[model samples]
Target: MKILICLSNVPDTTTKAKFVNDNTAFDTTGVQWIINPWDELALTRAIELKTDAANTIENITVITVGGKDAEPTMRKALAIGADDAVRIDVEPKDAYFVAAQIAEYLKSNPFDLIFSGIESADYNGSAVGGMVAEFLNAPSVSAVSGLNIEGGQVKITRDIDGGQEEVSVEMPAVLTVQKGIAKEPMIAAMRGIMMARKKPLNVVAPVEVEALTEIVNFEMPQPKPACKMIEPENVKELVDLLQNEAKVI
Candidate 1:
């Protein structure tokens, strides 16, 4: 099987977020970048599928849409077990443009399966994976929690209203994995790290696409209000306050 895993680089969870250019752009200075946590699940699962004895994966290719700064994150995916990496050298301005670039690349080379995270942490827009699937004319399942390959079909379990639903689709499909799909992806070990340095990483220019959205401005949310304290002895007063001021019975 030849699997393609779509990866993304994002700000580390601990990094402080700020805006620049009068709040028109994100302030990237002093920010540490890492692979998106949700993508890690898809990456790890792809590696597992490739290495499985029952259904061996012939190749696992990891691809990303970003500039040179994204190479390290792509290398990390290789160190974790992806066979090779490809980076579309471009600044991802919007999800639609990114999906278009990926779809254009995928048009030349077909893959048995494609994987991506349910949503990016920074944007929280869960649209790219499905858009890419649509562009490729492939079946797509989003926010999947479980996946298995059997009888040349991909079986996926996704969260529903209160439970989970399982669906099966044939090969040449796309899936966006949720958090609970697998355990946290492991970091690169010494041997894997050394091996990654020699792995193939191909860089290509991004395909052109007209952007559909533009960021007008950004502002931080207002600070939370201070807490209020009520004395235990003032039961009647509290009840009256709740009835009149608080408005909760």
Candidate 2:
């Protein structure tokens, strides 16, 4: 079995987001790029499944849709433990474009299992996984919290309203994994880093696909109001503030 995991390069969570070009594009200056947190967990789970003693997986490849500037993030993914990497050379304009590009690649190279995070940290538009599945005409499971192979069958566990549901899926299926898929992300060890230096990172040209959406402008959220503190003795004032200002009471 082979696994393909999708990765998205995103700004570090601590970085203050800013936009430029008249607030039409993101400002990448002085920003630290990291793998999407959810995607990292999916990659971690893929590595764990591969390293198991009774593993049946043969290769684990990570793919991303980005420009040359995104290679560093892809390298980090390889260092953490993917067997190889594939880059679809294009700026990921939106969920639709990205899903289309990756699906185009899968036309020639197929994998038994494909893992996509529930959403990208930057966009949080949980749509790519299902789009890929639709494009490939393959079965998919969403909100997947658990995934494993038993008796050569793919089993998936998902959280429901009152309980969890488990089901077995056939191969060549897509799974959109959420938080509980892995405990922690796999850190790149020194030896893994050295080995990653030799791992192939193949770059593929993206096919022509008209972008379905366009960003008109970027807007920053309004600043939060300052906190007001009142003495514990001022019970009446606190109640008045809650009722009038905070609107809680």
| TM-scores for all predictions | 0.92, 0.94
Q: Model 1 — which ten-residue stretch has the worst lDDT? A: 48-57
The TM-score of predicted model 1 comes to: 0.92
lDDT (Cα) of model 1: 0.87
Best by lDDT: 2
Clash count for each candidate, listed in order shown: 0, 0
Highest TM-score against the true fold, candidate? 2
lDDT tens digits by residue: candidate 1, 1-249: 788988889999898889989998989999888888988889888777767667767899999999999998998988998889999999998999999999999999889888889899788888888989999999988879998777556778989779999988866888989887788777788888899999999998877699899889999999988966789998888899889988998
Superposition error at 201 for model 2 (Å)? 0.3
Model 2 clash pairs are none
Candidate 1 residue spans exceeding 4 A from truth: 229-249
